[model samples]
Target: MNPWLPAAPCAPGTCAAHTGRTRLRPVAAALLLAGCAWVLAGALGAPFLPLFGPTRRERLIRRWSYGAVRAFGVRVRVTGAPVPPAGTPGTLVVANHISWLDIPLVAAVLPGRMLAKREIRQWPVLGPLAARGGTLFVDRDRLRALPATVRALAAAMRGGSRVVVFPEGTTWCGRGPGGRFGPAAFQAAIDADATVLPVRIGYRVTGHGAAAPAERHAPAGAAAFVGDDPLPASLWRVVRAAGLTAELHVLQPVPAGALPDRRALARRAQRAVASESANRSPESVHH
Candidate 1:
């Protein structure tokens, strides 16, 4: 078992439902409030955001994100040192792709725009809100769009925006290593002469402050947004489950000058994240 997350009384759902129910009223309220925050962010916040400036919008988003995560009943834990705030000279974060929760988990800690798949832009409330929040979308499947995407990302980086990119390109269940990091995204950092901060994400279940002896010690996949997993189903599973925590291992930042090219930078970032994921569980190591 990973020492950082010792076997706790919470084994995902055992007895956690009772706790969830006990606090159901407050959690529900928080969720409603979170939803309202998003709506306001889209309607009022983003539109008049420039009048207040990026800092205000960032603070608002961070508050909403933190509340949203709490409402979902997932606690986020960070390991290693924190990365520089967005707009820092060289602040690009590259993380592993796991659950849809990964976005909020990171956003709550480090507020900035994310590099997401084109399809996410069409997602109902999430898509619109994300766009209004400054998220940059890319059509990964279109080769022609790659250059423009990278250029846009680089420009954002140069402008001092903290940009997050999941080099894995796609999500994976914490079952094994995720898809290979496409070198394209690394160009943003390269072009901007920024450092790539590598972050590894994993999950654990809370046991309502009780010791969960029945814990199986397996990597929690309940929150994983893998293939064919419906968003509604995943959200329900996560929100209803008690004591879910996202473990973020923020590895050392890989400087752009240290790597010769984008591909090298991509491989280095992937290895850093994969290594951290492997450290989560002995059998969880990547081949």
Candidate 2:
């Protein structure tokens, strides 16, 4: 149960296969050591540092995250880079969820206030820091409070602060029974007629060991995700195993004005994201 070893191939298909790391292990380790220490200094210990400017703080957090991924020896290869013009009104950036590392990966690429579940706000070291990042926390089951969260997001957009939301509501390694996406989830945008940009996240797995998913009693891989977890517990094994290459691909952007109703727009954008996603389920990957 080594945190550095890669994930063991078990109970899994080719959805998001990932393996191999020796080549970049040292660099990844250095990034993590330096990046985590920097972010922790900024995030941990009560009150958090008084971030003078959101822009400056955003850069610090983002640089730390990108360093984290690279330090993990995880290569990110974005495709169809989303090039949204600057000075545009705050738009809603919607995307699908993949690994736990996803939050940092995408955020490193784009800076936008995130909409995350209330659970994330309770995380030990990262929780308080995320709150300071201006992320909107919500109790998913609180239908009554749902409106409030949506409104807050809308308000942020109106105020010129972009927002990112995962309407699917939960994470699934991007496979098997995708959590339902609330059709009206983007109602605020439709209400304000604001622009909604759909983003997609995918993890590419490679190599032999990358082909297995441990069983129910899979010797503590997922559970080993407590502290020092952005890099999965299985990372070291996966790295030592060999023959692996993972590439990240960011899809094209969809203009809100071009689509019809919010539902239709959501569906079209969903398809675009799924298509552009490299981790599409094995069965669907063939399509």
The clash count for each model shown is 6, 20
The residue ranges of model 1 lying beyond 4 angstroms of the native Cα positions read 1-44, 208-217, 277-287
Q: With candidate 1 superimposed using the best TM-score fit, by how many Å does residue 249's alpha carbon deviate from the native?
A: 1.9
> Best lDDT goes to which candidate?
1
Over 1-287, each residue of candidate 2 has an lDDT whose tens digit, in order, gives 32422232223233233333243666545645654565576575325435336666556666766665555445454545544644457677777654556666766766678888787898776788789777889776666787887688778887887777877655555444344455555776766557777666654433345353221111212211222334444344233322222333445655666677767877876776666243432222110
Per-residue lDDT over 137-253 for candidate 1, one digit per residue giving the tens place of the 0 to 100 score: 977666677799989988988888888887777677665666678788788898999878888887765454345423323456667776556776566666555566677776788
TM-score of each: 0.79, 0.68
Question: Tell me, what's the RMSD of every candidate?
Answer: 8.4, 8.9
What overall lDDT goes with each candidate model? 0.69, 0.56
Local error of candidate 2 at residue 182 (angstroms):
2.2
The runs of at least 3 residues in candidate 2 whose Cα sits more than 4 Å from the true structure, single-residue gaps closed, are 1-39, 42-57, 85-87, 175-180, 206-248, 276-287
- After TM-score superposition, the amount by which residue 142's alpha carbon in candidate 2 deviates from its true location, in angstroms, is 1.5
* Residue 263 in candidate 2, Cα distance off native in Å: 1.9
